[model samples]
Target: MFMEEVELFAVSALHNTATSPRLKELKVQQENDEVISRVLQYVRSGWPTYLPSHEILLRPYFECRSRLSTIDDILVLDSRIVIPHAERLAVLDKIHSGHLGITKCRSRAAQSVWWPNMSQQIAEMVKKCESCRKESNVQQPLSFVLSFLVVLGKN
Candidate 1:
């Protein structure tokens, strides 16, 4: 409770002191995010509560403790990464930058961050990304490649 209050105060100060409009706007959104606040509260209290659409994050769902930890009273996962559920889609957008394929996106997120069912979620998101689908390389069959090589050699 104390830590969350302090965080709120700091965020309030940050909003007031922000010099740029964009930064202040971003801070406002962060302050409003329920997922970030809930995680912080959970880490401080050491008790988990499942909310609507968040039942997957309950204790029994975790495969291992290696990826979970708390930093400065805020929940951290996968090497101290702070991933609020509300921000998952936004983060996914960044990780999928350059129109990465599913494997690349999965590997990228795996290295730095995690949440419940994170891998499955990332796969779905990558699959639905329009840019990635449009830009993905089409795989050529072995026969086609060999035939193309033979034709090139004859030419």
Candidate 2:
């Protein structure tokens, strides 16, 4: 419960600072997420030996069951926040805000957030980004470009 209070305080502070307006919303959505709520219940109570077919949405998480946990009402995998479906686009925006390409964006996201198919999503997002497409080496083909000057004798 102490952690919950601290998280609430942090959210309040974030609100006051105007740093991240969406964080509070994320928490609310996380709490309201029926799937996550059930997952939390399972985590706190106990997971059954075998999940039935109806729980398809949760099947992805089952493999990493040991790493799932709760911080306040937010679900976390290992140390990374398990972003809900609704917030993934926003999170992706933040991840790609620097206009960094796919690899860097994936590395940045790996540090703090996660969701199923996140890598594929990131790739897709970057692929669809006009700016990224314009700047991509594939468009320019730098690899085949001749060197500006090939120095012949360098001992």
Candidate 3:
């Protein structure tokens, strides 16, 4: 059920003119990615039920086998683009461009793109950003605000 919503959003995102130029570049990059190419093949053909020792590297793709598919030759997981490893960093940058923090960045990424360990990568990126850390440190009032809310709720 949630996959349906994601697919709908992905289709809409692709139709959005603001991102078309970048999407074109992404398509070319995805095609050139050896791993993504192999994954695409797996998506097109039936995925093997069991991975031989040599195919161990594909375990991540295998895990989400049911959700994998292709739209216009671009591999997708449900409706989200299966970002190639080469583009993951760039995608993460765009996701965190507003410095909105880890949760928002992950939400933004979830809306349009995906890859293995995407949430973990977002957390790491936000943690490493000095500006984000400084902002987080200055949030001493957050605890006070929560306490105040709790006190008010008990009245």
Candidate 4:
């Protein structure tokens, strides 16, 4: 029912492009994304029939109030991926590329992503943004000096 409609939406979003490796990666990754595959399978399977004896980390995912979802086969929390730990920085890079401040970045990311500490992660990244800091420091207008104005008046 709803899952079928979601699958249709995913399929429709895909397109064939001639030159973009990113497009290719996007096309493939959306459908076969494997980062959270095991957890998804558990949810899809209505599981816990047999937990692996040594597996411990599955607890958190199992308890997530946010349900797993997908768009074009890519796993998502809402519109954003419930990203794995290794890919968090990369995700931040994409979200913060415009050099936005903490609040703006957090708002933008909220549209597409979610995690337990998402806002904190955005704040940390914004703090470390050298380019944004440098740009802010360089763009102020200089005020006219009173002595220079007096000298010009004499001229």
Find the candidate with the highest TM-score and give its number.
Answer: 3
Give the runs in model 1 whose Cα sits over 4 Å from its true position: 1-57, 60-63, 78-80, 135-137, 141-155
Best model number under lDDT: 3
Cα RMSD for candidate 4?
10.1
What TM-score does structure 4 among the candidates reach?
A: 0.53
Residue-wise C-alpha lDDT for candidate 3, range 38-103, written one tens digit per residue = 877778888887866787767888889899987666778887888889978877787888898999
* TM-scores of all predicted structures: 0.53, 0.73, 0.79, 0.53
* Predicted candidate 1 versus true structure: per-residue lDDT over 38-82, tens digit per residue: 544554555533344554554432334344555433345644355
Models ranked on lDDT: 3, 2, 4, 1
Candidate 2 C-alpha lDDT tens digits along 4-107: 33344445443654424455566777778878777777877878889878998888787788889865556778767777777788788878877789999898
The global Cα lDDT (0 to 1) of model 2 is: 0.72
The true-structure Cα RMSD of candidate 2 reads: 6.6
RMSD of each: 9.2, 6.6, 5.5, 10.1
Q: Each candidate: how many clashes?
A: 0, 0, 0, 3
Per-residue lDDT, model 4, residue 20, is 37
CA lDDT scores, all candidates in order: 0.55, 0.72, 0.78, 0.59
Worst 10 residues of 1 by lDDT: 1-10
Q: State in Å the error of residue 131, model 4.
A: 4.3
